[model samples]
Target: METKKTDKILLFKGIKLLIFAALSLFMGPTLMTMALSDKENSLYIPLLIVACLICAMAVFLIFKGIKIIMSSMFDKK
Candidate 1:
C-alpha cells in the first residue's frame, strides 16, 4: 500500500494563482463599468479591451488553479 502526500509546492502555486484570479475577477468588471461609463472618451476602447483580456485571464487562472490543486492532491509522484 502506498500513501499519498500532498505536493506543498504545487498547492502553494495553485493558491497563489487563485488569489490573483480573485483580484482580476474584481478588477475586470470594475474596468468594464468604467469603460462603459465613458464611451466617448479616447481611452474607452483601450480600457474595454484591457478589461476583456483581464476577464479572460481570470477565467483561465481559475481553471488552471483548480487543475493544479487537484493534481497536487491526487497525482502520484
Candidate 2:
C-alpha cells in the first residue's frame, strides 16, 4: 500500500515536471526575443532576467524529471 502511494506520487511529480518544463521551454525563447527587440519598453531588463531564469529552469526540470522517473523505475518495493 505504501509503495503504491509512493509510486503514484512519483509518477505525478515526473509528469508535472515535464509539463512545466515544456511550458518554460516554449515561453523562454519568446520572452528572450521580446527582451532583445528594439522596442523601448521599461520592463525589458526585468523581462530579460526572467527569460534567462526560465530557460535555465526548463533545462533543470528536464533533467530532474528524468532522474525522478529513473529512480522510480528502480525503486524497491
Candidate 3:
C-alpha cells in the first residue's frame, strides 16, 4: 500500500484563512454593537452595512477553511 501525505502548503493556507476569520468574528459584532448604539448618527448605516458584510465573510471563511484543510489532508494524488 502507498503512504498518504498531507499537503503542507494548502494546510497553511487554510490555517491563515481561519486566523482571518477569527479576527473578522470579533470585529463584526463589535461594529454591529457600535452601529446599534448610535442609530441616529450619519455613520450608523454604513457601519451596519460593513458589519453585516464582515459577518458574512467570516462565516464563508470558516467553511472554506475547513474544506481546504480536509482536502489537503485527504485528497489523493
Instruction: Compose the digit string of candidate 3's lDDT tens values, residues 1-77.
Output: 98999999999999999999999999999999999998899999999999999999999999999999999999997
Position 22, candidate 2: lDDT: 99
TM-scores vs. true structure, each candidate = 0.98, 0.82, 0.98
Q: Could you tell which candidate, 2 or 3, scores higher by TM-score?
A: 3
List where candidate 2 sits over 4 angstroms from the true fold. 1-6
Quick one: best lDDT, which candidate? 1
* Per-residue lDDT of candidate 1, residues 1-77 (tens digit): 98999999999999999999999999999999999998899999999999999999999999999999999999998
- Per-residue lDDT of model 2, residues 2-67, tens digit only: 443347678789889999999999999999998999458998899999999999999999999988
What are the candidates' C-alpha RMSDs?
Answer: 0.5, 3.6, 0.5
Task: Superpose all Cα atoms of candidate 2 onto the true structure and report the RMSD in Å to 1 decimal.
Answer: 3.6
The better candidate by lDDT, 2 or 3, is: 3
